[model samples]
Every structure is written in C-alpha cells, then in structure tokens.
Target chain A: MYLRGYVSSREFFEYNPPQKIQNLAIRDYCSSNKFNYLLSATEYSMKNSYLILDEFLKFRDGSDGLAFYSIFQLPLNFTLRQNIFDKILKKRKQLHFSLENLALKNKNDINLIHNLFFIKQSYQKCLSLTDIKQNLKL
Target chain B: MLNSTVLSKNFLSDGYLKIRPKNQKYLFEIQKIITNKISKTKLSKKNQISFLNNFHKFQNPSNLNDTRLKIYNYINSKSIFSKMYYEIVKEYLDILVGNELVMQNKINLSIQLPNDKSSILPMHSDTWSGDSPFEIVVWIPLVNCFKTKSMFILNPKESKHFYINYKKNSKKHDSKSLFNLYKSKFKWIDIKFGEVLIFNQCLPHGNVENITSETRWSLNCRFKSLFSPYGTKKIGEFFKPINIKPASVIGFNYNDPLAE
Candidate 1:
C-alpha cells in the first residue's frame, strides 16, 4: 500500500500534525552499536544539514567530545565555526568502532548512554540506512 | 591588523575588543529578528539562578523529534543581516587566526547568571592545555551590557595567575567557590547593542547575576586556524585554501578602496 493517507489519519497519529520530533537514528546507533559520529561525516557531507544535526544530537545527552563539536559547529560566524571544528576533529578516535563504543570526553572519561530501540534489531542483525533515516526523523 | 578602527589597542590590552563600523544600522534589524524568535521560544523559570541578574535563551528541546527549528532558528537567515555578519566575521577571523580559516562550524546562545544556583561553570579559562592557537570567540550582544547584568572577563595576562590563585584561594577559603575569592580583583566591560566583542578563550571569563528585567542575548561563535588542535569530537571539514577580499564582497558598507 502507498500509505499516503496513513500519515494524516487521526487513528494512526493520536497527537496531530506539527508534532515535536527528534532524529532518533543517532541515539539508536550509539546505543546498540559502536558507530562513530566523526567518521560518518568525513565520508559523507549531507546536502541537507538536518541529517547531520539529527545524528550529532545523540551526543548531546552528555559527552565532552560531543559538546565540543556542538560548540564548534555553532554558526556565530564561519571562521569561528571552522576554528572550533578544527579543535574537535584533531581528537577523532583512530579506531573504526561501532557507534556503541563511542564515549564522551570531559575531564573524566564518561560512558556514553543511549537507550533507544532503533529499527534494525527486530528486522535484521544490523541497521539499515533506510531505518536509520526514518529514526532520525528525516 | 588591517583596519585601523577595527579594534582599539585598549580593547586588546584589556583582553576584550568591541567593533563598531561607520554603518551600524544592521543592529536594529537583527534586534527585530532576535526579538521575534525570542517571543516564540519557551521561557525558562523566572528565577532560574539566584546569582543571575537576568538571562534568556531559546531552548532546543532534546525531545523534539524534528530539529529543523534548531537549524533555521539561528541568526543566519539569508537576509542582509546574515550576509553582513558573514563578511565582518570572516575578515576579523582571518586577522585573528591567520588567513587559513573555516566559514562556520557551530554557534551558541547564552544568558549567564554568575552566582546563581542554576549556574554550572566552575571558574575556568576558555583555553585549556591542548587547545588550538587560532581558536577565538566573537560575542555580539543583542542588548546593551553593563556592570549590572554583564559577565566578567579577567585579562589574559592575569588569567593564568588568577586560575592559580583561584585554586589556592579555593583551598584556603574552605570552599571551591572561585567567585568569592577574587570578587574585587576582576575588571569588567560594559557594551551597547551596536558593538561586537572578540576575545581569546585564554582569558578567564564568566557571568553571574542578570538582575535586570531585560533578557540578555548573546550570539557567540568560535574560530580556529587551519592546523589548530581539536579535541576528539571530529568536526567534518577545515581550512579551505585562503582568500582575503573586500568587506563589501560579504556585504558590508565600506570606504572606497580606490579613494585611499
């Protein structure tokens, strides 16, 4: 089925249109696997800034490294953005690990927390890009 | 270094600089944009922090499933104001961090209340041990900032000493409250809306009580040199070649280049 009418149906969405949303893919990725926020962007620069933000926010729950990147990405002006980003990337994890293994970087080493149940678990052993996009609310 | 009136030496020595161009009409326009956005945002508790004289910021709710509001909600609308900011910041950053600079990576919104219980920052400098040299801050206030609700910035020369004295003072005073230690040793700067202040993160700074009724809004961003040291978060791209051009290219009014 096309599922076109399902989105607007009151039965389907008890809330309503204009509902507040979150990009859940990042949270799920971080929670269930050891995916790196740093590597994905270097490999792919999204024409859509929303996708990048949706993925990055999973770190905001609390991670020193993630906060730094958040500060760096601020668009006060381009140069400041670049400079902050420069500092953030100088510290990417060298190992290619799943999103689950990534950690926060404050004065103390923190265990990153992600309690999202992303779509990949029930359907397949690993996450699908399609499922990731849907969860990110993209 | 390039523009004579770009920043006064007094500002540099004081560890703070404010920039005001011949044409400052952009202030009123940006004020309208920010004000409208502020009205639409969720207001925080009336008494968020005791030490804060006053404060306000648009909260990007963590629970929001769609973050488009977070993205477009910034001051970077494609209007003339954004273009002007893009020009001014780009040039000044080149001067401060050298020619090799990146356009933008991140920005911040803050209304700091120094001694308020809601406040969380300990006395610390923007600069930590392994930071990149080019990293600096550009803070433009949406409202006039004065001694009352303003934040504190210790001179860079005195910051390191201040930090040491703070640590020592914290131990001697029987409390970790740095605010109590150097209450009188600090210098403060008062700013009006039509000004932009740039400071090196190495300088120690913090804001306490925002007792005023007016909500203090500041747009802040950090810039870095091409090869600056970034800690491990991994910002995607950096330093696109190098281009230093006329301010007008970014859409700033200027004295004629040919006239000089």
Candidate 2:
C-alpha cells in the first residue's frame, strides 16, 4: 500500500522530535510493514495549525493511507482530530500512527484512537491535582 | 562573587561544577529525613556523618535495593524534600539553566556499598538513553565521597570527540572496554557533604564499584528550562513545572483573539 507521511513542526507529546527524525521513523515504519513511502508533509509550528494536513486530505491521488509519527501529533482539539478521522474514513483511506503502532481502518479503530485521547486527557487532569505540596506549610 | 557570564562560560566548557550550597539547613534537613527513616536507632547530629558513611554495616548488603526503594519512595512522598533539593541548587540552575524550569518528578537515590558490583552505573550518557540534551543533573552527597566512592565524568571536549566517533568506537569495544580505553581521561569527582555538583547530562558519566571503606550515598535529579527541547522523556510523565514566570503563565492561558 502507498502511504504518505505526516509529521508536525509543532511540539507535542511534551517534546518535539526533529522533523528529520520524525520522517526517518515514519520511513522505517513503512519499510518494516512493506508499504510504499511518500515524502512527508510537515504541519506548521503554530497553535491549532492543521492546514497542511487538511491539504493532504484533499489530495485525490492513488495513495492508500497517511502515516503519522505519533497520534499525539494530531490536533489537541478533539473536534479537529475527529474531523480528520472522519475525512480519512470518508476517503476510505487508512490512518497509521508509527510511534503507537496503531491503525485506524474502521469505526472500531477510530473508537480506539478516541479512547487513547480520552485516557491521555484524563491523565493530564489527574496530574494537575496531584501536587498536594501546594497546600503544605513547607 | 563570580558573575553569571563567567560561570556560564565555564560550565559550557567544563560541563560540571562542585560548589557549596548557600544555606546548609536545607541540606541537613534532607540528610536528616533519609537518615531518620533508614536508621533503626535515632542518630544525633554528631553521629549522622558516621552513620551514613558506615551505612553498609547497619544495612543488610544483600537487601540494599529494598532499603533504597523505601528511602526513595519516602523522600519523594514529601514535597519538602524536593523543595529543599531545588533550593540547594537554585542559584546555579537559574544562572546556567533559567529561572523558569521543570524538574524531574522523582529524584534518584544511589546507595553504593563498598565493592558492590551490582549497583555500579556503567559508563554512559543520559542523552543516549532518551533524556533531553537540555537537562542538567544536580548531584548532592550525604557524606564525603572520594576515589571509587564517587562518580566519574569525561570532560566535554573529549566527550564531543568520543560521541562524534562513537560508531567506530562501539565496533571496537563494549562499555567496559570503552571505559578502560578512556580511563585516564575520566575525572573521578571528589565531593564533600556540604557541596552540590551540577553537570551536563550529555557528558559521559557513571560510577564504578565503591572500593572505599565508606558506603556512598548521593541523590541526583534533573532540571531543564520549561520551554527547552526534550527527548523521549516528556513533561507531565518524567518532569513537572517547578517554577513558571508570570508572562509564561499568561501566555499559556492566553486565548488568541483572532482565532475563530
């Protein structure tokens, strides 16, 4: 299958790996899975920027899928991420996350990805309240 | 007093600093907390140094990990311990790193028993194992550590050469043999109880078997600028914001007016 790589210039997952590093990881992932690799389109390093990704979705080429370096590289806004997923499903194109080694081929896969985002959001919420020391005298 | 510009330049080149803390009370408190928890019998201030130095006698050498984990968990559970840890090195970190910083969630405790082969840290850089190159390690000792009781680090100049040519070096030698080859170049840090050592984690550093009579007790934790580039060890998991400036706080919470 032919897969175009998607990488982000914006820092996510608390750290941003270099675009070169991200691209390399995607290339290796495609090679291991025996998929045809296409040059990556990097999202701009600005808040809520998914312009490149939106453009990638509009392409009507024979590419079978879009591979992301990580699922966290997707837009932080749930609606934006859902819209991307919806676009992928509408196009009948597969979505792959290299770091997570996950695939979104159907509604079930989309649900799994949604669950992961929920889990991460829940974790971040719990962490914000964990610093009990803030109330301590010391 | 040495200016920050000189200190930063020296730190850039040397990659490490051994200096005394501005206040000894916090350091004493930290030592007291660990000692009180570990020692079955209460120790007076006079005996605390001896107690820590000869800890192997009181502690079961075979069950070292159990004692280590207990103290590690105990100290980390107390927010004051971490607060004091940061306070001890706050000045240096502010100058070398920045005022706005993120600290490692859990500080690491090292208990090296005399000649214990199991606990030795092999020669390596934290950056090689997914730690951010921007992070710096603040290492503090509980007793006078010298010779084999302390850790060794390669200077940045030599480390640069070593890392650049690591591909050829790895094929020729393993970690042990690589250590032996560069053995003479390694600086065995001889640090005292009241002093704190801050070093660049990108430099190759580790400890050998503690051949000294005294057991070595040291604590190390990492700190980096809040906005610095990170490796695989991401924030909220490996690190948490210790201090944030007002502008940054406003910036983080700021909603762009132009956004729909």
Top model number, lDDT? 2
Go through the candidates in order and give each one's C-alpha lDDT.
0.44, 0.84
The all-Cα superposition gives candidate 2 an RMSD in Å to the true structure of 13.7
**Could you give me the TM-score of model 2 versus the true structure?**
0.67
User: Which segments of model 2 are wrong by more than 4 Å?
Assistant: A1-138
Model 2 chain B is weakest, by summed lDDT over 10 consecutive residues, at: B247-256
lDDT of 2 by residue, B2-85 (tens): 479988888889989888878799988888999999787888876888999988887888899999998997998797899999
**DockQ score of each predicted structure, in the order shown:** 0.02, 0.03
TM-score of chain A, model 1?
0.24
What C-alpha lDDT, on a 0 to 100 scale, does residue B175 get in candidate 2? Answer: 87
lDDT of 2 by residue, A1-138 (tens): 999999988787465789898899899889978999999988988887888888888766668989999878777776888998888898889988877656889988776565455444433543221243354532
Give per-residue CA lDDT, model 1, range B56-114, as digits (tens).
23333232213223433465434355445545556566556666443333345554433
lDDT (tens digit, per residue) of candidate 1 on A71-137: 2123323344334344544544111112222233331322111101111111123344455568778
